[model samples]
Structures are given as C-alpha cells and as structure tokens.
Target: MSYQSIHIQIKEMIFSKDVSIVEFQFWLAEVETFLCQQQNFVLVVRSVAGTTFPQEYRQIQANWYKKNKANFFKYCVGLVRIALDQVDQERLNTPALHVAWQVPYYVTLDRADALQWAVQRWLLCNA
Candidate 1:
C-alpha cells in the first residue's frame, strides 16, 4: 500500500520523502488500523536520505502514540527505524521519543541491519 510519501509492504513501512501534515495524519490512521487488527508484528520504518518532517509532525505522532499506548504494547512486537544518518538516528532514539514508542525501539543507518533486527524481534515476540 502506498500513500503519498508512505509505503507499506508486508511488515515494513517506508517514508521515501518529506510529507505534509495531511499525509502524516493519513499514515497515522493507517497505523491505527494496523494496530487494531491485534496481530503481533514488527514495524520497520525506513527513512530515505534527505527525508525530514516538521516539528508538528513529531507532536502529532507523539499524541497518536499516547492515545494508542495500550494497543501498541499489546500488538507491536518492536519498532525499527532505518535512518539516513547518525543525526537522524539519534533524534529518533531520544528519551522523549522512547516514551511514545514504549516497545523495543532500534534505530540504525543500515537498512539491512534494521530489517534483520526487526525480523529477529518479531520472531522472538511470536515465539
């Protein structure tokens, strides 16, 4: 499934470029729908190079996670982010973001490493 800058394939979601608030909201809605399905799944987010979002995006995402904390903890096995650089990775791995994530969160500059970690987490959670 593809929506604007967001693309979903199997258990992974890729953000190929910057997105508008409308696109961000739509992606959040998709995430909410996915969580509602009550299936254990690893969420891998790939942020391609040069992709960035406004501060409003963070606030909106944090709010969404706060509202869905219970369902996230119940269904999301782990969260893996494939960042473009160390700065991007660090930004996502901060304490404030951790509070919203709650689940095991891993951030890396390597897409292969991110997918490997996500798959391991998913298998472990299911096992």
Candidate 2:
C-alpha cells in the first residue's frame, strides 16, 4: 500500500504508510527535511497491524542515522507518537526498536491518544 506524509501548521510531523525499503528511505528523507526546517518537533507515525520492515531496511536506517545522528540531536526533540493497536504488539514496538536516533519515544493505540501525548509533552517542555 501507499503512504501519506503531511506537515501540519502545529509543527508536528505525521506519516502513515506500509511501504517498501525504497519508499521508507524516501519517506525518511522527507522526515529529515521537516526536522531540519522545523528544528524541533514531535513525530507521529501510524502503522498497520502486522507491519514489519525487513532487516536490511532496518540496517539501512541505522546506518543513515549513524551518519546523521548529530543533525538529529541538534535539531530534533526526540518524541515519537506511534499509532497502532494492541493486537499488534510486535508492530507497535518496531519503531522504538529500530530507531537509531536517541530520543524519548512512545506508542499509543490510537491517533487521539498519540496526539494528546505529543501535545502534553510539548506543553511540558515549553512551559
């Protein structure tokens, strides 16, 4: 299936997809672009049940982040809102496990909870 990546005015980065390695790489670059421009924001990812990336894709991501970790550390705040369901515990943990970048990440079962958590984190930091 396809993916959707969108940047809202609130400075949150959101993406929903079931993509291949190549598509994931492209999507990640778009995320990097947003992080670079926004400088610091929360990320919201919506994933389907049973979705998992190949080990090779995970390796590629790890390598890319190893090269760009400093940039992410410099510009990003490191909070992730993952939207998934309890039925897919494995998929729910995939992002947190695969991410090479250092940041406080979280997973939620729904978009509303994810958004609320992200916003609360934002408010806590800004306050």
Candidate 3:
C-alpha cells in the first residue's frame, strides 16, 4: 500500500500509511520542513500496518531525534497516534511518548478519535 501526507493548514499535518523506513524518512523530512514554519502544530500519525518493533526502526528514530530534538520540540505542540488496536496502540505510543515527553500525546483506536484529539490539541495550542 502507498502512504499519504497532507498539511490541512498551518494548524495540523496528517500522515497515513504503511511505509517502509525509506518512505517514512522521506515523509518525515517533508513534515519537518512544514513544522519549521510554525510556532506549534499538531501532528497526527496513522499507522495502517500492524506494529512491528524492529530494533533498526527504533534506532533510526532515536538517532533522528537526537539530531533534531531541538527543532522538533520547538514546533511540536502535541501528537496524536492512531493504531489499529490496543496492542498496537500501546506498542507504538509507549516509546513515542517516552521520547516526546514535552508534548501531549493522545492514543486512539480509530481515525475519528485521532482527529478529535488532534483538533482539540491544535485549538489549545493556538488559543
């Protein structure tokens, strides 16, 4: 399956896909560029694929964060995670929240919850 990335406005960004590491990195770079223009923005991520905790993937994320943490925190107001089920949600959210503790994170089982949480966060941050 293919991945999609769209900026709904200055308020939010959406990334939905079952992406490979390469695709994820490309999308991430695009998102980062968008975030750089904002004071704060809500980030919504929908992982349509099932969760798989590969060490390589985790390492890549960690390394990317290490290299870009300041820019990341400077613009990220909150995060919304959309997972297929409880197990996937927990598996993805746990580590992500650990790394991005400065931002509020909402984990949801469906797209509607994800969008609701993200919109609320965007409102709060912009307010």
lDDT of each: 0.78, 0.62, 0.66
Residue ranges of candidate 3 with Cα displaced over 4 Å: 1-18, 50-55, 93-100
Model 1 superposed RMSD (Cα): 7.1
lDDT for model 2: 0.62
Cα lDDT tens digits for candidate 3, 1-96: 499654443333344444467865775686577467755667777654543333467677777778777877777767776777888778867865
The best-first sequence of candidates by TM-score reads 1, 3, 2
Clashing pairs in 1: none
TM-score of each prediction: 0.77, 0.65, 0.70
Worst 10 residues of 2 by lDDT: 6-15
Off by over 4 Å in 1: 1-10
Total clashes for model 1: 0
Measured with C-alpha atoms, the lDDT of residue 34 in candidate 2 is 50
Pairs that clash in candidate 3: none
Per residue, candidate 1 scores C-alpha lDDT tens digits across 21-117 of 8878887887787688767777888866777776699899888988988998988878888777888888888888676678888888887898889
TM-score, cand. 2 vs. native: 0.65
- Residues 1-127 of candidate 2 have per-residue lDDT tens digits of 4996543322344434445787778867866885567555566666555566655886888787887777767555545545555655455566556464466667666677777877766555544
